[model samples]
Target chain A: MSTPLPDPSSEQLPFEPRRPVADADRQRQSWNAIEARLQEAPVKKLPIAGWGRWWWAAAAVLLLLAAGAWWWQGRSGAGSATSYDLAYKTISTRFGEKRRILLPDSSVVILNSNSELKLPADWLLDTLRQVWLRGEAYFEISKSKQPGVDYFLVHTDRLDVKVLGTKFNVNAYTAQTTVALKEGRVELLYSQRPGRSAAGLRVHSMKPGDVVTVDEGPVLTPMLATAPPDVMADWTSNEYHFDYTSLAEIGRMIEQRYGYEMEFETAALADRTMSGHLRADNLDQLLQALQITLNIKIEKKDQLLKVSVP
Target chain B: MTTGAMPSPDLQNAWDRVLAGHADGLRQIHEALYASMIDYACRLLQDEMLAEDAIQDVFVKAWQLRAQIGEVQSVRAYFFIMLRRHVLNVLRSRQSRRRQQQQWQQQVELDPVFSAEDIRVQAEHTRQQQQKIATAVNELPARQREVIWLKYYAGMEYQQIAAVMEINYQSVVNLAFKATQYLRKRLSG
Candidate 1:
């Protein structure tokens, strides 16, 4: 532990990773590209007086964003499979943060807090519209007018949901993958167990309001039912809507959203379930609601939250 | 190549100009930090073109978000932090693909013949010593390499490095110490 520190200043560290040389032409070309883009979007200067003028700029920016989205998606048709392999893009949200991402084909994905969605960098430009999800996301896929390439695929650890331009919410935070269909139809494809052959892959078709939760068992058991209107896609509106969700599952959601570690005073406390909604904007408020509704006491210390029966 | 231990006055001035809605300020900031930023980005993303594109996006985003950006302690750290987050997003997207490539690389490194070739190529003294240092630095884990680069090449203090890496000051100090210890052992033994 008493080893003297090595002085880095006295020694020459010859580990330079390709320092860019001052090439005049290259510099000019790079600067010009930046300059041209800057010209398209000017800095917002006036806070109040610029409101009227700002709306015009806002409209222009939206148009440019739409066009850029189209360009990225349109250019993907010519790229080879190798290019797609090298062109994966991941969009994620930090604790207590949510983001809305518009895919190449104009499919909208509202990623939940502490969630990640990985897809081809060019959006839906891949021959097969495919994406991988971890955590949770609400997807409103735009139906492709074209027949052969209309289906979209969402892969999780437990199952894959093949979509035909439907609105759905996917929660894959745990080993169990839950797909709640809000509108249209989706086909759930997964094997009963790992290392199963292609013939073992099971496909379960879903209709609107269908909620199928595939358990993380050696033999995966899928429980199919219908979720109430408010239970699904509620997080998208900044609310935690639970339909008799167990306290353990609620604790996991809290852990994911607020980066807190939850511990139960007794294992039995985790089994108690709660239903209905709580505003997700503030942590303390949500916890207070839990206390009032569930009659359990939660004590928070630093990064840990402990729940006990009152 | 050195931009002083203190925050560069030119960068601060350029940032002020950028806040005031002047394109020339951005140009000055770009010209000053472009080389170092691009080098850092290239290390994070092993693709040259992607690094260049990422740098360009950083500058463009900086200009766009100028109005909302609050006062920053150091301009260099701010730009580095911004670029770091941008590259991390890109890296996360390519995680599965890159993991496979890294597994293949580990298999190659495990081959005895590859180590023999490395030993035979170390015949020359001075040049080999330099190469050995480079290889040692490169062989360090990703976080260690990042710490070493930010400290030595970027000439940043531990506090600034912590801010750029979004870690605590103690964690940065520990990482820097751990990295130096590894490098010393590799170079001496």
Candidate 2:
């Protein structure tokens, strides 16, 4: 007789309680250190000491210097029509339209459809070039001959893009803020307002071919990695290309694109992440591709598709 | 379902101590509740690290927002709900990354031999039988798999599972029964 085959249930299972590893203790220590640092850091308080007065004076002097530097930089350029309060004026564009704005400091901005730009009425000659944007725009900043006075800045709802002399496109929609550096160098700050509190803004400098998305919160931090250049500008070309997108987010996108409701049968299945792109016109074709590619099943009842594991 | 209300006084005292920033009191609460929290997170994410991280973040956030942490209807339930939201956020974020074509997938797939009923079986014979049962369980439909996990792993009552899953309790019971029957057939085959 042949030897009896081992039952699958009779095999030694890998279920065992994991003991606390040495790394866990190290993690605990690191957490404690961080807590301690937070506790020790300066807390917000009313300043009352003589040294506090000195600190206030020092702060005032620094502010004046910064303002003076800004004014000086704004005035350094010649042959350009300069307005004292150019930034206070607001410029906007409607859908299916583009507007070219010539700032007094000689910086050029090409605003795309459904875009808005708000700048100061009088752009101080010696100060930083700053402007607010709501939609997509391409910036071509002119270089200043004077040192320390040539930096150009674009402010979005969540980020500040600074350029010395470069071309960049910023798509700062409320849902997603993206900065793509086409050439030269650009510095992205994490605020509409800069040079207030250091903690108020997080900054990142980008080189050409770099694209950053501010996805997490109000404070715009650059994404850890740049997306592929081909798919990064897909929105402009009406081509939707997602490298790896979750089903839940895809559900949201589907809702936005076709105005349909989609839900997952299980949270686990909802949590299932899929990566693919479809050029189809409707939801059924996209779901068909998704189902075949990801080994997922979609049950369509009326308008909703309940996505689940096959 | 049992309301399962514990003495509210101990929870209130614990809350006071936590509000006072006593580390030991916080640790005591953690010790009292960590198992259930970890289990809920594990059921949600199917990853131990992610579950642990969720628990740790819940504790840190609770401490940070101690002022806002209102009176305990049930501290355990409150803590579980909070941790569940955190786990959901993690899941949502992981899903977003997955949408972007990222390769990191948290392993949540259960072994095939561990049936929902087998989880309740404490005997050595059933422990030996777990592998076959788990395999059979894995072969069940997606809805059946979820029903099994919610019942056994999270220890949620049928009604509680219904509420959390947004499904009828009858459907949950039917799914569980079907899942068990499928496992039995697969094992016998």
Candidate 3:
């Protein structure tokens, strides 16, 4: 295969003919193919009568004025109206809440607390099954038997999880996004910056029992041997297991699950580690268990939970 | 055919005629963009007949919506955008219908030869084959391939490419740069 560096000055491509010449036969065939459809729908013409033309012209003038003003506004707003933000429908869960959503394609998403999922509003019309995720979510994506429609994409701020009908848990609430696949296959695509161009993008395929965490930089750690996939997804069963996890990390999880402002007496206390299982479903039970396990005093003033060594 | 670096005055005049409800004007626009549009759709859909159908749909829809299309900055960009959207929607619906039919067949007939696993593997194979462009360009991701196509082959600026691809302009610029760098390195190596 011949690969020539593309020349900006030239109009032709290196790999294939940039534009195949439209020979007479092909052009005629194309014209004949579309001529019938084109004729079926001619441009609708407004009826021009004596007084109606004047009214129509006045209405057209007003319409043009409004359109011009809108055009100016759109230009000033940097084309926000035409941007992709309007194309999505967002579903969010509040703190201490979990919601189950059924996508248009019959896929199931179990949204964890304080997470948001932005699904394309026009899913049926779109060629891509793409959804934006903020925070953690467990997904059981329905597999597509068709060729072009099989790819499902889950986009986070740090990574994109591409899968073909896989069961996986994604935690994107923090700076680092972790993806643990329970069943089927998944491909993690990420760049140094989320939604960056394909240049910095990296793709890593994950099979069942695979766990990968992606940070803001080039730190991608695949911890399949260290962490069990079942432990990763056990949160769905209301089980919290920590193996030598730092108190700072546990504080973040408590904040997300209960909407509390966590405070430690000192930096050392925040860095203190714990290893145990806390199966409490509610905040009080979890806090009681924490106090009993760590020999610490907990003071709750409204929504703030402060920890201090007694 | 022009590479569409600049929107031609001829296309602008043809678009004006189209807005004025002239079928011949629409014919002119169609004839001018036929080859490039077909090539683009064929590359994306990989089926000439479907590509032709998609082009026909674009023209018919363009004529139908001419009154509402108003004055676009570039008639070439408008048509390409319309063609791209129509082709994707067609592929999505066609594939969706095929999927429903497959599920129905599974429930009713349960053919051992055409099992669900066979179809899944075949679908996976087709996806791999789609990525096999048989050139250094094949190494680029799907989105990068689009950026390369629009920048090099379609002769579109970053802004126009961004509009058609529904991404931001900066992304298109970065993608083009990344793709060019990759292609140059691969070719040189």
TM-score of chain A of each: 0.68, 0.47, 0.67
TM-score of chain A of 3: 0.67
Model 1 Cα displacement at A187 (Å)?
Answer: 0.8
Q: Score the docking of each candidate (DockQ).
A: 0.13, 0.01, 0.18
The residue-level lDDT of candidate 3 at B142 comes to 75
User: Which TM-score values does chain B get in all models?
Assistant: 0.80, 0.60, 0.78
Lowest summed lDDT window (length 10), candidate 2 chain A = A78-87
> After aligning candidate 2 to the native by TM-score, how far in Å is the CA of A57 from where it should be?
37
Off by over 4 Å in 3: A1-86, A192-195, A217-225, B1-189
Model 1 clash pairs are none
User: lDDT of model 2 at residue A102?
Assistant: 60
Residue B42 of model 2: what lDDT? 52
Query: Which regions of candidate 2 are displaced past 4 Å?
Result: A1-310, B1-25, B39-46, B66-69, B101-120, B141-150, B159-189
True contacts kept of 2: 0.00
Please tell me how candidate 1 rates in CAPRI terms: incorrect
lDDT of each: 0.70, 0.59, 0.67
DockQ of 3: 0.18
lDDT of 1 by residue, A1-310 (tens): 2222233344332211232323444455567778877855754655434485465456444433443233234222211111212355555566666667656566888887677676754432225677777789999999974447779888776778999988999999778778999998899988875753466799999989999998777677899989775568887876788878998988988887668788999999999999877764456667777887989888877777888887
For A228-285, candidate 3 gives per-residue lDDT tens digits of 7667766676678889988788888988756788899988888888897667655665
Q: Tens digit of lDDT per residue, candidate 2, span B60-156?
A: 7777777777565556546766776677677665555344444345643322223333344445646546666666666777668767765665455
